[model samples]
Target: MTLAGTLRPQYDCVVVGAGVLGLFTAHHLAQRLDPRRILVLDRGYLSAGASGRNGGGVRQQWEATATIRLAREAVAVYRRFPREFGYNPWFRQGGYLFLAFSEEEAGRLRKVSGVVRSEGLPVRWLEPHAIQRRVPALSTEGLVGATYLSSDGVIFPFPVLWGLYQDLRRRGVEVRTRTEVLGLSREGPQWSVGTSRGTVRTARVLNAAGGWSRDLSALAGLAVPNTPTRHEILATEPVKPFLDPMVVTLRRGLYLSQSMRGEIIGGFSLEHPGEGTSTMPSSSLFLREMSAQMARLFPPLASLRVLRSWAGFYDETPDGFPILGEDPRAPGFFHGNGFGGHGFMLAPAAAPRLASLLLGERTDLDDRLFGPGRFLGTKAARPVEGLTLG
Candidate 1:
């Protein structure tokens, strides 16, 4: 690794975006190559995007086999973080409980239970009474059944970001914040990345721009099938610990869990899709609908004061899976932007695999399902179902 000597005309690799995915990828790149040759650029503060604002629920309750595999590996990486990186991310293994209010949802959970169990993950189908047994405070009056994955839980996203950022800085990785990529062009075999700050030349460039990924792809003269939608979350004032596991209701498109400080932090899906960049207050409709649903789910928290609320956009792909791996036409370029809503949970594990691919090392994991070319006539190997909105 060498020192940053002004803005060089060439670099081994240039990673766009300094979010969790970008920093982790840059860290892995630094590990495999000279850190001096790697430059990480972001348009905003570290983890300022969805990576930081999202409710950090880490679980393997995915419908698709591929997503389940990725999540399985990701949660393992998150669990081992304290020992592996000497940073306690505060991962709570309180588990995740998916409550199904309607019979249709319950049936779906039954099928998903088979899928996860087939993968050797400890997901079991539970009756409403069983759901009550796990989290007594939950209102299961209308619920038919639920799915419980005892190993699933939550972690603090900022701590994880700090840990990874420290590693990148120690490895001499140059991270430029508030530096947005203005444009990108392919000059023969190398890529030229023009940024709001300055121009960067690198042999390879990775797009991990989160919500702005599509625009970045267009800037690079490529078409990426992705959309950014706004998701909102609100935290209530601290109260005595009541619920134990993270509760999710697919039929209602709501998820809730208690933070370490005993504040109930959660959110629900909105029908209106959000577009463009705007961190405005959560809509009145969200406040009304989400609050109503939260009250129904946990009647005990009906009196909890709403502390505050904010919204962030998620880079959702066509099939609800991320577009990973190198682009065929855009040579020496890669996509790690679309994790839908699962980017943070998938970061710790996805980084090492992406690094191996960039370093030309062998990997057993098949990232082809997440390739950009999949939208270009390639049939996706897996499909998404079940209640997943993290």
Candidate 2:
């Protein structure tokens, strides 16, 4: 909380990464502690990572009870984001329509529907005709069935970052972009975080670095079970508004939605795993596959010229869930990574709880549901979250 230096010699809590998850956690941390005591450091500028390059689909249908619960809260948070964060992310609750092209995927959706319904959210099992009724532009060629939750939504991802960044700055939370963490050494009860700027001491540290999380953990002399996979998305030139809900095909692992600006922004799953380096590269293979799938799904968009394309990394876990909370291997170091491609949606609900944990408060999810230690030994073979599009 010192005002004398450009980079302070000490902080009460130092958050690694300035992405949505990092900023959101710092925002909550500022609420309970002196904002001056919190420091947010990122190697790149805001929205330079996955936070900037995602199709903002927010849905509550998840395979795990914890994920569904978190997603349910995320929808509510986004609904009131403008009032809460002083910026409008243009969140639209037009619902999320998940289609199943095969009976295998159909069965998966049925199970997910049951799990979602059990969590106090209503989901409708729709036949192909019903799916067509929702978005008539969609072609039901290999469609089996689908599930729909009218409350599910999508948002503008950039403003969510700007809103949180603006709010954090206003609250005196120092978010230092282009300041990368070089090393993490245990200094008795505190952490000596060596950054590109300077070394700072902190009683607690949260690794919310997303894609670079595994590398960050290694800096602290700990091994984390998370992988970085590059996924690409494309935005077509604006057209007249047609699509209402975010449409996703389970068998194809592709999702698409119309932005408020009328550009159809969409992305699909690809397999490009990384080894702790920061590189986001777009691919012609992605364009070929996603474009072909998008046009085939909606015959009307067959001739729609693509305006631009980009890539981002999903910090994946073997089980498709995020690893949160402190690690046993390192005493004071904590983790907030491995949310994969869905962190933007889940961060709203998760950040506050993680901040509370950082401030030495016991929260409900500070346990095994998202714990960093959950992947130890026999627990490593956890159940995978099936509703994942990527």
Candidate 3:
């Protein structure tokens, strides 16, 4: 609702960061708890995080089973979002086409495809000629093979955020923007949270602070190894719809998709000169690298003019998996961060699971998989997810 300036004396749960994950988790929590007892605090206005800066690509072709399951669930939710949330996010299921440059990448896709098929999804392996015919403009010179899944798609992110925010407000959840969390301390079974506005007491607190999540954890005497990497993206001038599926190049992490409005939106990664910092500003190095890669893949893109460009942080971890579940050290505290660049896509599905964990309800996404304690202890060499793209 309004950017609430004052803080309530007490709350059942306080969710930090009003980004996509925070809003979605609060939405789920409101469904079970007294809506007024939950509060979402953010340091900036809505659409200020990676949720707004992303290319809006959603896919299920991931290396890990947990990640693929979460993405599959998100696609299903988006398919029914209009009926569930009364908002049309333009969930276009045009499909996602991933191009492989080497046999190593091709074999990885082949293996990951089996995991996806085991999850009951029809992921197809396509030859270079087939991929060329599917997208006539793409020049598949070094393309060894590709993967196609028609069910995986993209959505306009703003509608998802607005719809969730409005629906949460309708259910009486208090959302306070421009309210930054300053300090966190445990007072024996209760939490005393200090904020820029005022102090509030809440037994339960969920850190979905995104790129700043690790910093927030340290406030509560926890040292998380999450690092921030600045990534950039660009949008090309509108052209007649010529592409269908979102095209992805595994080599450079280059991905391009046409928006419903006809703009070619995409993102890519270059050598990071200064990563692990939270400052976000579009860089010339990124623009030069992205333009060259886009032109090399699809020569037609060479003529397209750049409309805009921007940057955001991907809160990455050593192993490329999101840190979820509650912290054992802090009894009532929980974490929903370390999602890297794909947080927006995973928000809808992961939020409900995180809410379940916060309420001590059993969920399929258990602590063993995504718990904040995953990186700790002698058994920390867990399975690593390798399909992390910027």
Candidate 4:
């Protein structure tokens, strides 16, 4: 499984970044194109980026129509991963409960629930008492109401990445790790991708670099509006299985869910101190904020010892949605970054659509919503607020 052999000088398509999105795109491309013609390159090892550092939460509940549809389809793909790829990601369907502590927040949740239900998703309005019934550990003192979607849940990310990587290798797709894409230049119809290892001439290049996608796009002389920000998460020591559904507090931007190993794993959005892409170090500020919020919601968790803390970058966009489709400035360049925090959940559905576009096939999902041209004033940008879920 080593890429020690002499590298091919050319490829039909060179996918940058071997994260879930890039791997899945390569997987789907193998179905239509020759596997040998497709290549995946990453700056680090597989799943070493945001793809491996996430909480693995998957949900269909979204504020935007396109995002909701994408999530629903992704959940289906996640459920079939074990059988399709021979790797179980431990996809749990315990559901997601968004808690609201104020009337304004509850109203927004109700509106979103209505929209989600109208779109044929199984969502229900939960009063404070009903929410308390589902999780007796939660404090309902100031909770106004909540929205529950039973189908939304979580999955183990490592197994998914491993499954995709193994399957891609089995299909003869070249996946080279630690191969940083240094520069991209267009010579006629081919794209010259300069890497740390060597130069690869590719017909098309897909920017799936996650947090570093914007920087990768810049190498091609393309300016994308995506910003990479650091997000932190921590886990507690394994305890008894008590929390069933992933709980999200909309007010404080806190979300938590118990893993299969019985550890409470989650994170919260804080007033980030640093600007732009800086050091991704976990702050005591996050720990203090998370602890206070968790204790307020669930008092017993205060006693549980925090195992460890880590931070990862989130490729955020102004619209808080992903940037997809081929770049207008760079002919053979495609953008698939700016997923914010939901890239892992949306990758399954997004990858196929992106591949379809690359292969010139009619895709079911609307590609325009995520196209990079929107920020260029070619299309209107419909920003999805209150959907990042941190």
lDDT of 2: 0.87
User: Residue 178 deviation, candidate 3, in Å?
Assistant: 0.7
Candidate 4 per-residue lDDT, tens place, 1-390, comes to 455665689999999999999999999999989999998998789988899899899988888888888999999999999999999999999999999888888889898898799889989999988988999999998999889999999899999999999999999999999788999999998999998888989889999999898889889988889888888999999999998899998875799999999999999877575566546779998998898889989998888889999988889998777888888887888887898899999999999999987876676655556777878865554655457874
Write one digit per residue (lDDT tens) for candidate 2, span 204-286: 99999988898898999888788888888999998899898899887657899999889999998877743345568788998
- For model 4, what is the alpha-carbon lDDT of residue 220? 92
TM-score of each candidate structure, all chains considered together: 0.94, 0.96, 0.97, 0.97
Residue-level lDDT tens digits of model 1 in 1-390: 122345666789998888889888887888779997998887778877888888899988888777788788888888888887778889997888887778887888888888889999988888878788878888888889888998899888888888887788887888877777898999898898887766878878888889888888899888878888788899989999877788888864688899989888898888554456645357888877878888888898888888888888778887777777788888889888888778887887788878877776766655556666778864646554334564
Tell me the TM-score of model 3.
0.97
Task: Report the poorest 10 consecutive residues by lDDT, candidate 4.
Answer: 377-386
Backbone clashes in model 3:
0
lDDT, candidate 3, 1-390, per-residue tens: 566457789999999998899999999999899999999998888888888788888999898989998999899888998888999999998889988899999998899899989989999999989988889999989899898999988889998888989998899999988888999999998999999989999989999999889899999999998887788899999999989899988887888899998999998876576665557888888888889898998898898899999988888888888888889888998999999878978888999999999898888875666878877887655788788873
Clashes of each: 0, 0, 0, 0
Roughly what TM-score does model 2 have, to 2 decimal places? 0.96
Inter-residue clash pairs, candidate 4? none
Looking at model 1, the pairs that clash are none
Q: Which ranges of candidate 3 are over 4 A from the true structure?
A: 273-278
How accurate locally, in lDDT, is each candidate?
0.81, 0.87, 0.88, 0.88
